[model samples]
Target: MTMDELLHDPEFIELIKQYIDYLKSSVLEINTKLANGEYHDVMKFGHNIKGSGGGYGFMELTDLGKALEIAANDENKEECQKYLDLIEKFVQDKN
Candidate 1:
């Protein structure tokens, strides 16, 4: 089903809510990992976001995830922070 229909489907409401919650918590975890200089975990977090965002009909999240992955690979604190901010903002907007 299309994202709009999926989102509006009563049966999918709980699943969507869970996905959003996951995104929220994951953002916090990734931020903490970045702060701790844990590039490996950060990259893994980004990878997870990349893999799952589209399944939840959040394509923008996929792009953000990719950027985050590259940022972690380069150990770019500024870039990581930027993408994290974008992620948090996107989640907030969705809510």
Candidate 2:
């Protein structure tokens, strides 16, 4: 959806802010895990991100998170990093 269409709901926007905070925290945790080679935790984090992003109506983020989750599950570190970058870009552009 376009930014104008997505921004129409005040309540949703508020919820999105909260979710974005959660996303940021989760991203940090995931980064820490990845840094330590804790791949399973990273996968779990990506799964959480995917669910929460979809719940908050950030479909692009949701898709990116899903791809990350899948890549994590498959032990495809490069693809997972790509998806992570996509999600970061989406969040940065939106905010």
Candidate 3:
């Protein structure tokens, strides 16, 4: 189902909203930690997103998160930035 449809449904709307908030917070946290040269939190956040996105019916996000996790683990800032950019694009496109 599309995001609009999900939002239209009373049951899923609140959950979706919460997920969006989570995504926003996750992004901010990742950015902060990355700026501090901390890869662990970035990896942790990516792993959480990878595991939870599909549960929220957002497999695309899960894919991006997986890429982010891998990049962070490898300490590849460029690759991690690429994945983070993709994730931001995904969020913008979806919302």
Top candidate (TM-score): 1
TM-score of 3: 0.84
> lDDT tens digits, residues 25-44, model 1?
98888888899999988888
Summed backbone clashes in each candidate are 0, 0, 0
Weakest lDDT window of 10 consecutive positions for candidate 2: 86-95
Better of 2 and 3 by lDDT: 3
**Which ranges of candidate 1 are over 4 A from the true structure?**
none
lDDT, candidate 1, residue 9? 94
Which model is ahead, 2 or 3, in terms of TM-score? 3
Q: Please provide TM-scores, in order, for all candidate models, with all chains considered together.
A: 0.91, 0.78, 0.84
Model 2 over residues 1-95: C-alpha lDDT tens digits?
66667678787688788777766666667766666777788788778777877666677777777788888889877777777667666766666
Decide which is better by lDDT, 1 or 3.
1
lDDT of 3 at 91: 69
lDDT of model 2 at residue 31? 66
